[model samples]
Target: MKVLVGADIGGTKLALRTTTPDGTVRVDVEIPSTGWEAAPVDQAARWLLDRVRPVLPEDDEIAALGVGAQGCDTQEHCAHLAAAFEALGVSAAVVNDAALLVPAAGLTDGIGVIAGTGSIAVGACAEGTVLFAGGWGWVLGDEGSAPAIVREAAKAALAAHDKRRPDDGLLSELLAHYGVADAPALARAVNDTPTPATWGPAAPAVFRAAASGSASALAVIDDAATHLTALVSRLRARGAVGETVVAAGSVVLGQPLLAARLRERLGSAHPDLTLRLLDVPPVAGAVALARARYGLAGVA
Candidate 1:
C-alpha cells in the first residue's frame, strides 16, 4: 500500500502518523522531543528520520511526506529539511507546528490557536495567504502558553510575599515543584534555564490552586485567558477570517479552570465568533496535510 507520512514535533513529544491516500491510518507512534532547534538543520532532520525509520519498512511504497515541526518556520529551515529528507524520494512540505491545529480541528479555513509550551495563532486567508500572530517564543511572546502561565504564577506568588501576606500554598507549590528552598531561589532556578520542559509542568499547579479558590492564582488564570483571547483578535485584524476558531494547547486542554475562563471570556467578548476546542491531537493535522499531498482525503 502507498503511504503518506506526517510528523508533528512539539516541545514534549514527536508524534508521527502514516496514512493511505484515501486517509486510512496505518501507523501511529510518539517519541520524545529533543534537539529540533539545533543550529545545524541536518541534526534536526536526523532527529525526525530516526523516529520515522521504524515505520517505513512496513509501509510498502511511500507516497508523500509532511512535517509540522516546532522550529521549521522559515523558508530557509524548510529548505534544509527538504534536503535532509531527499533520500526518501517523496514530495514533502515543512511547516510551523501551530499549523497542525488547523486540520486537527477539521477546518480547511479557520484560525488555529496553540497554547502549549508556546502560544501562537495561525490562519490562512481565503486567498491561501497565511497570517499569524504571537509565537515569538517565551521571551517576547507566547503570552498565554504553559511557560508563561508558570512564570506568571511565580510572579503572583512573589507579589503576595511583598505585601507581607504570602500565601504559603502557592509559594510552596512552586518551590517544591522546582526543587528550590524559597521563592527567590525558585526564581533563580527558572531564569537560569527556562526551557518549556522545565516550566510547563508547573502550569497544572497554577490551575489547581485556582480551583482551590486562591485569589492570586485565579487572577493569573484570568490574565492568561485574556492574553490567549487577544491572540484570536489579532488574527482577525490581520485578515485571517475563518468559519470557526480551533484552540489547542496543553494549558487549555487539561485545565478546566483555564479552559472555562477562556470560553467565558471569548463568549462574552466575541459572541459572533464561532469557537471550537480542538478535539484531535495537533499531530493529526500533520497526517491530514500528508494525505492531502497525494490529493486524497485524510483518515485521521
Candidate 2:
C-alpha cells in the first residue's frame, strides 16, 4: 500500500500524520522537537525519516511527503530540505511552518499568520513565490508573539517604575511571575534570560493584568495587534495574493482579547481582507499539500 505523509515541525513539537490517498488516516502522533534541527538538510531528513519509517506498516511505502518546518526561513532552504528527502528516496515538499495555516484553513492562496512563542506572516504570490515578514525571533522582533508580548509588557512596567508612576497591576504581575521583589531585579531577571522559553511562559500574566484593567497591559496588546496587522500589510505590498488571512498559534488562538483586537485592526486597515482563525491543526495543511503533490486531491 502507498501512503501519504505530512508533518508540521514547529519550534516546540512535530506533529506527523500518515494517510492513504483517499484520506484515511493511518497514524497520527506528535513528538517533541527537542532532538531535531531543521538545518543541514541531510541530517534533518534523516531525523524525520527515522520517525516516519517506524510509523509505516511493513508493506506500506510513502508515495509523497510534505513538511512545514519552523526554521525553513527561505525558499532555497525549503527546496534544499525537499531535495534531501528526495535523495533519501522520498518525494517531498517543504515550506515554512507559518505557510501551513492557509491550507490548514482550507484556503488555496492567502496570508498565514502565527503568533505563538514567536510570530510571522507568510503568503505566496500569483506566480507561487512565497513571501514572509516578521518572525525575526522573540529577541529582535516577532512583535505579536507570546514572548514579544511579555517582553513589551516588561519594558512598559520598568519604564513606569523609572518614572515613579504607581503600579498598574502590570508591574506587580511581572514582579510576581518572575519571582523578583523589585523593579531593578525585574529588569535583571528579564535581561539575563532572553529566550522564548523564559518569556513566553510568562505571557499569561500580561493578559491577566489586562483583564484586571491595567492600562499598560492593554497597550501592550494593542501594539501587538498593530504589529501583526503590519505583517499582513507588508506581505500584501510585496505582491502576495488572496484576500483572506488565516491566523493560528497559542497566543492568538488562546486569547480572545488578542484575537478580537487583531480582527478589528485587520478589518480597519485592510477592508478588503478577511481574517479567519484556523480551526484545524496546521499539520492538516501539510497533508493537504501532500495530497496535492500526489495528485490525490485539491486544496483550494
Candidate 3:
C-alpha cells in the first residue's frame, strides 16, 4: 500500500501517526521533544527519524512524509529538517506547526488560533493563500500562551513574595507546583534548569483559580483572552476569514476559562464568528496537505 507519514513536533511532545490504505488513522506515538530545537537541525531530524524508524514498513512504498513543527516556517528550517530525515531514508516535507491547524480544522478558508507553550493565529483563503498574526515567539508575542501567562503570573507571585504577603492564591499554587518555596528559588530554577514545558502545565491551575475568583489569576487570564482576541480581530479586520475560528493547541485547549473568554470576547468583537476546537492533532493537517499536494489518498 502507498503510505504517507505524518509527524507533529510540539514544544514539549512529538506525535507520529500513519494512515492505512483504507483511510484509517493510527493513534499517536508520543515522545518528548528533548531539546530538538537547540541542536543542529540535521541532528534533531536524525534523532526524530531514528525514533520513528521502527514503526515504518520495511518495504512499503513511502509515497510522502509531512512534518509540522513549532517555530519552523522558513526555507532554511525546512531544508535542515529535510536533510536530516533524508539521511534516515525518508523524503519529508516540513511546515510551521501553526499552519497545520488550517487543514486539521477542515476549513479551506478561515482563521486558526493556537495557544500552546506559545501562541499564534493563521488565516487561510480559498485561493490557497495563508497569512499569520502574532506567534512572534514567547518573549515578544504569544500573548495568550501558557508560557506567557505563566511568566506573567510568576512575576505577580514574586511581587507578592517581595511584599511579604501570604502565598494564598494563584501565585501560591504555581510556586508550589514548581516545588519552589519562594520567588528567589523560582528565579534560580529559571536560571538553572527550566523547561518551556514546565510552565505550560500550570496554565490550567491559573484558570481554575480565576474561575474561583482569584483577582491576580483572573487578570492574567483576562489579558490572555484579550491578547488572543486581538489576533482574531486583526484577522477579521483584514477581511481574511468567513466564519469559524479554529482554536487549537495546548494552552487554549487545556484552559477552559481562557478558551471561553476568548470566544466571548471574539463574539463581542465580531458577532458572527464561530469557535471550532480541533479534534485532531496538527500533523493531520500536514497529512492533508501532503495528500492534496502529491495527489495521494490519505496519509501512510
Q: Best candidate, lDDT-wise?
A: 2
**Top of the candidates by TM-score:** 2
Q: Give each model's whole-structure lDDT.
A: 0.78, 0.92, 0.74
lDDT of 1 by residue, 1-300 (tens): 778888988877888888777667788888887656723666767667767877665635667778887766555676677677675565676777887887877778888877888888878767776677788887676878888888888888988887889584777778778888976798898888878777888888877777677888888889988988898888777788776778887877877677788888888777877777888877788877767776776444
Q: Point out the worst 10-residue segment of candidate 1 by lDDT.
A: 34-43
lDDT by residue (tens digit), candidate 3, 186-232: 77765465556666677776776677677888888888899998988
lDDT of the structure predicted as candidate 3: 0.74
For 1-300, candidate 2 gives per-residue lDDT tens digits of: 998999998878889998998889898999887777888999999999998888777898899998999889899999999999999999999999999999888888999999997899999999999999988888789998988999899999999998999999999999899999999999899889777788898899999999999999999999999999999999999999998999999999999999999999999999999999999999999998888878876623
Candidate 3 — which residues are off by over 4 angstroms?
38-48, 74-93, 125-127, 160-168, 237-239, 297-300
TM-score between candidate 1 and the true structure: 0.89
Question: Of 1 and 3, which scores higher on lDDT?
Answer: 1
> Would you give me the overall lDDT of model 1?
0.78
Candidate 2 local Cα displacement, residue 221, angstroms? 0.7
**Greater-TM-score candidate between 2 and 3:** 2
